[model samples]
Target: MAQRAERTERTERADAQRNREAVLAAADALFAASSSPHGVSMDDIAAAAGVGKGTLFRRFGDRSGLIAAVITSRLEPLRRTVREVQEATGSAPRQQVADLLDTALTFKIDNRNLMSAAEDAGISSPYQAQHYGWWHETLRTALDRVPGVHAPEFTAHALLAAIRADLVAHLLDERKMSPEELRSSLAAHLDNVLGAA
Candidate 1:
């Protein structure tokens, strides 16, 4: 009887894990195919996930909530990377700053939909504050290594704003710059701005 109960528990856990994966995968595909975050419906997500409507709502609460869940999950790796960089690196501030910029840009490229979805969800005020706080702490820690630098907080904000999806998309779509060129320009611009401060 105990063995049977253990097997049942394992099966339930596996099913839950599969459901979570399906939801996120469906969300990614739906978001990518849409021009805007609002363009995708809950039904679209459900169909893509091979899930019932009840499952999605039961797991994610609402569309905005689903977006938040997806974004948070996708960002987990990025947050880990930044945290590792902060802990493991003994390099100069200039290199560390560049590393942070590169990582942020890479993340933006890979998770464009999550960024768009987050914006569309109207995550303002305290949400924005928490976001900035995380970036500022990352920036301040690295910026301390740069010679004769000040205002790490403001610099962090500038770096973040400059590397945002809208700006990068504008550069790619409107300006027609290649990814390599955009990255080069971004790194140069960041260094220039930090140098001035």
Candidate 2:
């Protein structure tokens, strides 16, 4: 009976993992297709995932928690890449700063709508988010390695602000800047910020 119980526990864990993945995937698709994240309710996500609303709240706590989980799931791979680059020996700090901010800008452009939804869900300050803290620390560490930066902390914040979700949305949605154009502009802007070349 003990062995049977252990097997049952393993199966339960596997099912829970599957459910988690389904929820994240369903939420991702819905948020991506949504013009506004506010309209995509927990019930909608639960229906899409073939789960129940209770499960979503039990797993993710609330709307903000669920949104953060979805964003975190999407960012997992990007986080790995950022870590590898940040820890690499002999990586030029200025170029590292450029690469990091450019990647962030691209992500913000791609997920602007979902980000807006997050703000609507009461994640009002990006500065208050955990991921924002990680990016700020990581960028500041790289800035610390550069020659001329006097205040790595402030410089890191400034660089990150340049790629904020709202600004990216306005540039693309309002000003009609293509992703390529925005990227090119950011690159040049980074060059000035970090110095020539």
Q: How accurate is candidate 2 locally (lDDT)?
A: 0.86
Return the TM-score for candidate 1, rounded to 2 decimals: 0.81
Q: What's the lDDT for all of these models?
A: 0.76, 0.86
Give the Å shift of residue 47 in candidate 2.
Answer: 1.3
Candidate 1 lDDT tens digits, 1-197? 99999999999999988998999988987776666656788898899898898999998888877877777777777788788877887877788888888887877666665566666676664236344467667877787768777777677777888877666666766788888888898888986886653
Clashing pairs for model 1 are none
Q: What TM-score would each prediction reach against the true structure?
A: 0.81, 0.89
Clashing pairs in 2: none
Writing each residue's lDDT as its tens digit, candidate 2 over 1-197 gives 99999999999999999999999999999988876656789999999999999999999999889999998888889999888877775668788888888888888888887776776677657788877888898889888988998999998899888887767878888899999999999999888887786
